[model samples]
Target: MAYDNTPSFDHLPIPLTSDLVKTEHGQVVFTAVNGAGGLETKVVDLVDGAPGAFAPRTPDVRTVIDRDSFGRELRRRGLDSDGTVWASRAKGRVTAVYNDLSTDLDDAYTRRDDRLMLQFVTDPDWSTFGNVADGQYHGQEEFGDLLDDAGHLIISHQAADLVELADSIRATSSGHFESRIQRSTGSQSVGWSESVEARAGAAGDLEVPKVVVFRVARFEDFPTVDLVCQVRLRVKGGQLLLGLFPRPYEHLLREQWQTVIGELGAEIGRDIYATA
Candidate 1:
């Protein structure tokens, strides 16, 4: 079977020891593991009768692991990553996870994280973005060649506090532009999972610095992204509008998509990654 470690929206009971626990390295039998699992189990005396009580034993090496959590809502409140590998499971170097999920996903599998993001060779292709009625400064990149229904989901801030939005996707940090996945139905969709956003800021308010990479992916092989367009800022209904547009990569992205379908859902062999 495919090594499917991707997070799901299904409801599950409190996992017990011996139960298969999903990790990046495939399913492993669950153990007391850590405080999150054991604490709840030990205090409440969980049903599975998980082993014995805690004791001081040989010092075992432990690394950070991200436990999956589920949410119930239409438009999600934050970023969601879909990957098979968790580098932090083995590498004990990380202390905190305040960074973006894309970087973490990229870092887990390979060192060539830079290869995932695409560089825009041309200037802003704003030929399509022109004047609109009612003084609405609205425009959008041509997403015909790019994936449809999953392209250009608009993020409208309640106020004009997003004036610095474009500044967040500078060349130094572009992958994060649409770094956050907006919405996913958990079926029949590849990368470009419904208009990613760059709202991965450090503070709870999400002031700045959320996502930078341009993301695109294919069907098989390690999940990856290819290209991303620049962030376009405009105003509609007194709310600041933000979106990532597909400028030059439309044809290339489509070609990669077509190639993947042609090869029976094989890996996309192109250099499409999060745009940085």
Candidate 2:
């Protein structure tokens, strides 16, 4: 059976190369029907300029996505007013609502069960940091404070490599570790074995962790999340700068970034394009 071959706004792995798109059959001329009108129109407006040309139909958010405010998100981004759109946070989720064309897709990119997490990720105070002496800052210290809620947060090595590195700092090395909920896992595959404890230790040493995986209890329960994070730090001018960068799961996020551009080209649904 044939289909519309519609592509999402941030669906493509790599954006269109001009009006041409690569497909399984072969490359074909590309075109977009987007929320901002079309590819050509969006580009023209971007270059030459066309402000407020496409005022959102429900700019005031009068049209609620649903009545259950305590459950699913009722808000949306006005620019994503396509027949359907997918939005997620930490890149692990993919959800879409097949609107009947009347309901505007106006929710923010990601809606969370924990509202504070949404604000913390999207809007953070980056200026409150002060210089910490050498020993003052420890393993993921600065970033750990972001989740001060007791019993609702836990972080651990996300990968085999990081696990091995963590093992290097301990008195003994275990081939496997458990998740936050006391669930045990199988042995991990890493370049360094349980012997890493002796190899990396030398006269009492400590090392800060770089890339790690963190999980938050949704609504103060469950621990299925596996969000990746990396410590962002730089030192210069006698000052130390530090920050945290959140990322989605490896397979989940990296793969979804690729959007399908086929014979029908793509239906942008809405045109404020961006990287997933």
Candidate 3:
């Protein structure tokens, strides 16, 4: 069925490529749409420029072929507006795109989701266990701590070998990795952990060593104390070994702690199976 091919922001002049898209000073701009169906813009700090533009602009178009076609192209290019895709044609090229969530998406997109309830160690100082000389055992301790705190695992042959592990995995790899703070209480008391994970597309059976570092911290409000955790992983040989360290914190309910542990266990299993 044919669909309407009208731009939502008909009132605002269609942004031109030459238009100065305002961004936060020293920040990269990512423009997207909002839930209200308005133009949204976000800015990210520039590190070294990657292989592509930080905020790619869609071609300006006076007309679109059809709604579906436009939407398809926007999604293909990783653009979205208010959960809707933006499509248009400009400069003789059919184009579709979405704005960056930071700029165009609502604050809700930037807000943290709810914390996952799991049983966590009450001691906030549990991160201390990660201290050891750089070695294989150290890598293991780090992995264990990460599994304990957050719900992720890292495998590596040596503690000092994590960068190499990351390099090896990134090379000839077909997936991606994401890092973020998992959960945190608004106050110093009561929160979840931070962690990182790698995802690979199905490809050749590649074996790389794994290594991880875990960091956890605890605060004393007694029952409502906050727990913070961080983990990093690396690949070892043909198999992925993990090093994890968990931070210590209090006030995490048993259910929450169990959930975290479960996630870590599942990730470990996946890591092993993937290597196999």
Candidate 4:
């Protein structure tokens, strides 16, 4: 039987492309989408953008198409209002596509339902322990001091890389927060194998902004390098989706994220966005 609403991924406007970076590894492309009010912009890294390579992988296109399709379907089923889908449900699709447009259509469902993401990456050199230092800074900090620096804290492994990273965060925040260790399961695969949750105050206050500090593991075999520490502030109950394209997610996060960035910069003694 043929269904009237099989969904179409057509009629979407193509974004004009601008080459941003080209290296032996790959190229990063920037694009702007013309909309009714203004233009929406985003950046995509083309892993296979070298000459004679196949069509570039454009997850942003799939992202836009799936959003339109999902919204249309929701409106047709009379469930277009807010909160019809929980953030937890929307964030379940945790796959990242690097350079495979062949899978884009297959992954369209996941892209359609994805929760908007905001991320902050301090320079790998932000701390000696970060990826920029050739991994020489591991286990350099006093382990016991980290655990005792704040209350309600525990150290899963004295040698865990996150400890040093967490210490940098605590020092940057002026010791106002404590750290609790948590691990990512088969789900929530934002790439943090081990993470430290930072809470406010020694006893840990629930009302303050929640921060998760973790290291995004690097694939040594991959052409790209990604040995960096990340700080993710929980959005929690607010609208997770920021509709502004081209604008940095850090800005979309507004004051809350910026406050943490400033604190980190002060602690590490470098402007986080100066190189960007």
Q: Give residue 15's error in model 3 in angstroms.
A: 99
TM-score of 4: 0.14
All models: lDDT?
Answer: 0.29, 0.32, 0.32, 0.32
lDDT of 4 by residue, 1-276 (tens): 986988874557566656577643457788787655567787776665354573433323223122234344334433221212211112211111223223345533322332322122233322322222232221213322432332222222244544454454334332222233233531121111122466432432212112222222111111222222222223222211101011122232234334544553353333334211
Q: CA shift at 200, candidate 3, in angstroms?
A: 18
Given candidate 3, what's the lDDT at residue 174?
28
lDDT of 4 at 18: 62
**Candidate numbers, best TM-score first, in rank order:** 2, 1, 3, 4
lDDT of 1 by residue, 63-143 (tens): 322211111110132223422111111221112111234545446443222111111221121212211111222322222
Candidate 3 vs 4: which has more lDDT: 3
Residue ranges of candidate 3 with Cα displaced over 4 Å: 1-221, 245-276
Stretches of candidate 2 off by over 4 Å are 1-144, 147-151, 157-206, 216-224, 248-276
Structural similarity to truth (TM-score) of each candidate: 0.19, 0.24, 0.16, 0.14
What would you estimate as the lDDT of candidate 3?
0.32
Please name the candidate that would achieve the greatest TM-score relative to the true structure: 2
CA displacement after TM-score superposition, residue 96 of candidate 1 (Å): 50
Clashing pairs in 4: none
- What would the per-residue lDDT of candidate 2 be over residues 1-276, giving only the tens digit for each residue? 898878775743333344644432233454444333334321222211333553422323222222132123423332233333333434322233333244435743422121211111211111111111111323333333332321123346435544444345342222222121111142222222233455853222223345445553221212234555555444333223334465545464334333321110133333212225
